[model samples]
Target: MNPSIKKLSDIAQKTSKTIIGLMSGTSLDGLDIALCEISGIGPSTKVELKNFASVPYDSAFKNRLKAITSVPNVSLQEVTLMHTYLGNYHGELILKCLRKWAVAPSEIDCIASHGQTIFHAPKQQHNQPQMPNATLQIGDGDHIAHKTSILTISDFRQKHTAAGGEGAPMAGFIDEMLFTHDTEDRIVLNIGGIANFTYLPAKSKDRPSITTDTGPGNTLIDAAVRQLFSKEFDQDGKIAKHGSVNADALAAFKSDPYFRKPLPKTTGPEFFNLHWVENKLSKAGITNVSNDDFVATLTRLTAETIAESIKSILDDKSHPPLYVSGGGFHNPVLMDWLRKLLPDITISSFENLGFNPDAKEAVVFAVLANEMLAGEGFKMESAQTENISFGKISFPN
Candidate 1:
């Protein structure tokens, strides 16, 4: 047997494993690297986030990625090249983080890489009867493993699409495993480039879990701030705070059929982008919207859409706690709107539950890797989903 396979077997049999998770979301802000100490499996899983960092991308690199992201057409050459480029770059970044934390490559068991999402096209978005639901994430695991001399697992979304899911919002399994409560129902909201939430009913309630994307989170706001205001992000919602929401523009933003779709649906920056916003504004016959107001309304749209989705899932009398994670949680304007809209419910950060909100997604990928290696088949209640033992693995030889 290969030494790498033997080592993997040993690691899986161990009580705990040291793993690193990498997440590069549609926002294109940076790579989130999380070093987690994970133990047990399934509902008994325990994860300790030992160290984490978000390495910001330089403007040139961001532009290069933006060139191929979320569009119908692109240079195939660039996409192929970026797969290797991003994987090696991510491995280099992880090594830097490990060095800063006084860790070594050999000490880590595996790296779970949720590579950058280039395009996500569910059947709902494409409206093609002949084509199946599809999505694509670049960054090859082989490059990452070879670069860092560590085992790697990646390209996790394909299994979902193959299993009849939209290949998105893969948080339901983890949320149900980590956040379900016996007495209190919970909603774990992750507002990445595209916002999504997992509704975990209290174990006592005997309700099935539901997970779905709730449209744009920080994608549009970040885009408007960069293109219009010449900034990377709203940065504490200062731009949005200085402006007011345009009611007409907000209504136009919400007029999309995606919002009316049933639960368990998915979307991405591919669907909710600047061009989509401009078209909606034009359809509403509204113009001359200021930059600050543009961001403000977009921010409100994120909060409103998220709130509407959460409300739709809840029974009128039961208001479960909503714990938020991801970039949208840092936006005061968005959080304030959510509070005003869901006054009866409790809203808090994932920190309240002992997890870093920003590092949550990276940690989630790490947990998934742990599951792939050590877990006994765990499945969510919705859609007859398969077990959690997925992800293609690469051995460091």
Candidate 2:
């Protein structure tokens, strides 16, 4: 038998495997590395975060991604270079993290990397005929496996799109496994660069849980901050707290057809970026809005859209508590909007459930990798995500 295959066979038999999961979100902020020990398979799975870290990219690296991702067109060479560069960068980042965590590469069983999402244009967003629902995440799996010298699973979304999904809100498959409640219908709402949620019905048999991207989570706010104040993000949303939301601009922005689309929809900064915001402002005929006001309005827009999306899917008219995760929960202004808008709904951080919100997404990828290894043709299905085993594996040998 091949040495690599033998190693994999041995690793699979272990009771608990130490897996490293990496996530570089659309925010272009940094890479999230999560080391998780996951056991069991499917709904019987158990996951525990042993260590987690987010290594921020320096301005030069982030600028490179922005030039490649945020723009409509770019040099193909740079895009090609970025694909390889990001993979090697992330692999080295994982090695650095392993050193800091005082663990050897041999100690880890596998690596699950959610490569940087540069473009997420579903056919609905592009509106181009003959284009299937599409999305792109860079950072090659082969490079990661070679650099890390560990078995790696990457590019999990391709299978999702191929399986008739919008290739997003991939959370439901894992969220239901990790955080389902038997008596309480839980909404595991994640607000990363894009806001999405997993609706886990209390009784899994009666109504299957669904996951969907609500709309702009932190993407627009981050873009506006980068444009107005030359910052990657509005720290604690301080700028927005100082200003009032422009009702006219908010109304105009809400008029988008994307908001009217049905559930199981997906979107990204491509449709909800600074350019989109500026266009909305122009249509609203509001030219003199201050930076703070613009930021406030964007904040309001995210909260309103998220609230509305959640409300739209309540089959039992049951307003369940939201267990929130991701970067948006850190912004007090955004949190405040949710509180003020949905006064009766209980809003709490994922930390309340003993999971770091920042590390949740990374942990998810790790869980997915675990599923790939242990699934055993297990039936994994949700309303949005099809019953499919994702992630293309790369061997380091």
Please report the TM-score between candidate 1 and the true structure: 0.97
Off by over 4 Å in 1: 380-388
**Weakest ten-residue segment in model 2 by summed lDDT:** 377-386
Tell me the lDDT of candidate 2: 0.87
Model 1 per-residue lDDT tens digits across residues 1-397: 9898998899889899999999999999899999999999988999999999999999999999999999999999999999999999998998999899999998999999999999999898899989988999999999999999999999988877777778888888788888899988998999989999999888998989988998999999999999987899999999999999999999988999889988988998888888999999999999978888888999999999999999998879989899999999999989999999999999999999888999999998999999999987555343365564668899877
CA lDDT, candidate 1, residue 42: 86
Candidate 1 pairs with clashing backbones = none
Compare the candidates by TM-score and give the number of the best one. Answer: 1
For model 1, state the Cα shift of residue 18 in Å. Answer: 0.3
Q: Which digits, one per residue and each the tens of the lDDT, describe model 2 over residues 69-185?
A: 956788999999999988999999999999999999999999998898888878888889798878889999999999999999999988888776678878778888878887888
Q: Which stretches of candidate 2 lie over 4 Å from their true place?
A: 315-317, 376-386
Residue 5 local lDDT, model 2: 85
- The stretch of ten residues in a row with the least summed lDDT in candidate 1 is 379-388
